[model samples]
Target: MNIAKPNSYRSGPDDRGHFGIFGGRFVAETLMPLILDLEKAYTEAKADPAFQAEMNGYLKNYVGRPSPLYFAERLTEHLGGARIYLKREELNHTGSHKVNNVLGQIMLARRMGKKRIIAETGAGQHGVATATLCARFGLECIVYMGAVDVERQQPNVIRMEMLGATVMPVQSGTRTLKDAMNEALRDWVTNVHNTFYCIGTVAGPHPYPTLVRDFQSIIGNETKAQMQEIEGRLPDSLVACIGGGSNAMGLFHPFLDDPSVEIFGVEAAGHGLTQLHAASIAGGRPGVLHGNRTYLLMDADGQIQDAHSISAGLDYPGIGPEHSWLHEVGRVNYLSATDDEALAAFQLLSKLEGIIPALEPAHAIAKVLELAPKRPRDHLMVVNLSGRGDKDVPQVGDILRGKSK
Candidate 1:
């Protein structure tokens, strides 16, 4: 069911960076000035035509803009219902949607005269993008990754190193994405002068959530034009997987006010929502973590709970504040898929469509297996194939071969 359209769902995070009560600057006193400075610089750069032109040049020649919105004919026929189109973000340079935001941030960092770039990553896609951009811009780059992730996503760690980035593995907490972010934040606070924290997702404090979403919105923006060209009408549905929810937000924001479009944000259910899983909105309550107050997985004493997902990128304990706002208002339907289901979809897409999707978007594809078949044949559905599965091949191979669980 569609929620009645508001005056405009696009207007959000009022002057103080709040989306209702969900998003705000919940940072340490020491970082406030830096955050404010970033906001100011981003505002000035946004208004400057030269900044946009420079970023556009790099996006086209470097990261590759307007990645194809191809019809997944084989997969759609296999499902036998809604017409499915895959937004091929996986074809982007560095092999994910992360580069779209990094290019913008790195340019902004240069404008602000910041010489160092630091970031945190779980799946390594974002870290790779940041390192690539820093290397291109001749800036010092450091990436914090969980010790567990550094072990599992070894290929990405190597990629970052080759790009001249120093990768620090955080061993605290669950030794995963959340812990890596914790270390990155501490580094930002201590070295707040020359260091620029290039957040990978849309879950950070204030301007970060806004900044990342704006950069990534190109996905939805391009999809709109491409869909019109292909079908002569707006799409009926949009789907993407959510960890910290940047990719989903990227695809959903541009269409939020379109009541005709039904949006779904799929979260990874590692085992099951009732078991050890990463479906935060499904299994958890509202709380604060990593500078923003949003939905998080926590315990009786309000301590954070560990999250599990087959996809390293979707294994975070919380979601973006804008997602929380959308969830509360019933603007987007949030669904989830188990690891087993995602694995099945992963294999199905590879064989049927010859496209290897990253495990994160596999969660969305798993749901589409059910959702598409039920819709009419004329129903147009677009799914963001957010990244390619090359990085996941090793882990998936081990699981499928019964060498590891």
Candidate 2:
């Protein structure tokens, strides 16, 4: 497992955070100062070895760094083609990879002297993670979630509340992740003085897309080292689901330079691409939203369209700006999985590998199922199991029962 690092894919998003014309600061004039201040603080924090040591200590002692890269022997035998490995992010505290970014952001918030923390969540994983850290640090936490998500992901919502975080449900628009983000932005603009907006994904303004990616890059970094130790080389390919694309980016960023490692990003196709779905790159065009220019679901009149997906986590109308740029540059292959396909993969992994994946990562597993069988048995593939299915069991059960009828 010799590490093959490519230098071609390392550089990105110049000083202005433009990932080749995709990402930039497209925020309100009033927010510019705050964004700049955050960027400067983060730049300094990144340069300080003490900051890195502190974050590393927390990651190891609290959020559980270096999540296992376990080979799914049963699933590999079942597929009988490519060898499959699961990057067990679900094994982390809070049951997801979302904690990786939240912990880093919250640490930065504390360092910035901000007393209040505000965040937006789609499936409640990010909300729960944010709440958990705020409770740990005794910082005020407010999480904004869509009304629909609040109902569908009640367990996580309850967890946030129990952790002493206020959950505000936004009923506007499609009553989903996009609307929740809008409301969260409003809160940030109104309370900029004391509030530090901790974006859940790598899709916010300039510094945010860069900042979140750097924090979450730990996933890719760990995977590289673990795979090298196990197999004596890097994986042949990597796969992960994308909504705002943080987890996928985290796993993909470090491997970007590895030309031999094929990267695949799976987007949620709710029903089908022609109908309701959250396959942003497949069905979207370049547009500006949530402070960055990226591929977005928009109508002919340039109005944002409603996105739908069975997985609450991947039900967004747009993706991370870096993904948008990567798509244009032909750096990574973008694929999609329907709700039915993801559901089937979810059950298959639970039965074969004893791993019940969250619906979000199920999309990636679905893609692996399709590609693994076509490749040679010696081909190595890794899928980022971004979260556990504990929070999705009830929703999946209801859907399964409905299908039985």
Candidate 3:
């Protein structure tokens, strides 16, 4: 697919796309037509007044938008650096920020008269969220999951099934998140006409990055007001994990041009940045695949690399185009934390704050502890609590036992 297109649905994506030479539509031929169609539909839907009103209503009443921007008093005292605050997306229904995007996609599906809603997930939070929205809307739903993730994150797999959505276990390419994405693309190809592919994150074709960001931007919008109420000014920093970049984009987009608020995107480094298992952005070269032009882990011939992370949600080679752009332009700093570090932070937050965060957010926790101690104690730091840990307890247990520390 060509990089230059005329759709404006994706916010801040450049005419040449590369937030600073980092983003553009990159995908297979069969899927291009559908991706473009989605772009048009999304552009129109976003512009329509009635559609906007309906989406707003669902966000407010159904998915419970405007989640609190809470002060972490105890966590702050422990870190003794930045005055810590958390945008508690973990409190959202279905236990993550995934519901926000699902609601928007389902509404678009309804408007399009689509008969079925299909989605791809990693940690299964997005799968469960999609299934829940499908159930609420009375639409048929199917979720494609990697066999590895399905087995490791069983609670979420079962939750999807119980929500009346069929769960298809994908078995290919390490049986992880990337494999699941390949399967999802195939499914979209086979049933493009009647089915709507509700990609769980911001990493997909053109409109998806734009669509998911707008829906999830409720995070920043709510935080803006919440911060004003307490701290009386914008935060000094905002941090979130960058799996396909949805939660990060949601929380970071509004603050992009603010100039004062520093933004950090923590990627899963797996074993470590130099290790073979790492998925660090700094270790990767810029390339395009899976629908958009962005930084992907590709070898000599541009074949995408397989990714590994203790957090299934963070196991992917490429990030959303917008993130790639932001990284290049210095609007955002994309950093990495090894799995061991993230796991350590996971245990720390659960034990210290009584909040067991999703593994993806644990990356942020690790970074917060790493950076917070260096900053002034009064500097405001807003960490996007992307999801809860109910789905991760089992995996966390296994990883902790396997460490043999």
Q: Going through the candidates in order, what is the number of backbone clashes in each?
A: 1, 3, 6
lDDT of 1 at 94: 98
Residue clash pairs of candidate 1? 13-18
TM-score of each: 0.98, 0.97, 0.94
Model 1 misplaced regions, further than 4 Å: 1-5
Query: Of the candidates shown, which would achieve the greatest lDDT relative to the real structure?
Result: 1
lDDT of all predictions = 0.94, 0.94, 0.84
For model 2, how does the per-residue alpha-carbon lDDT over 159-181 read when each residue is reduced to its tens digit?
A: 99999999999999999999999
Kindly report which residue pairs in candidate 2 clash with one another: 1-232, 1-233, 2-232
Clashes of 2: 3
Model 2: worst 10 consecutive residues (lDDT sum): 1-10
Ranking by TM-score, best first?
1, 2, 3
Q: How far is candidate 1 from the true structure (C-alpha RMSD, Å)?
A: 1.4
Worst 10 residues of 3 by lDDT: 1-10
RMSD of each: 1.4, 3.2, 3.5
lDDT of 1 by residue, 26-114 (tens): 99999999999999999999999999999899989998888999999999999999999999999999999999999999999999999
- Better structure of 2 and 3 per TM-score: 2
Query: Which lDDT value does model 2 have at 62?
Result: 94
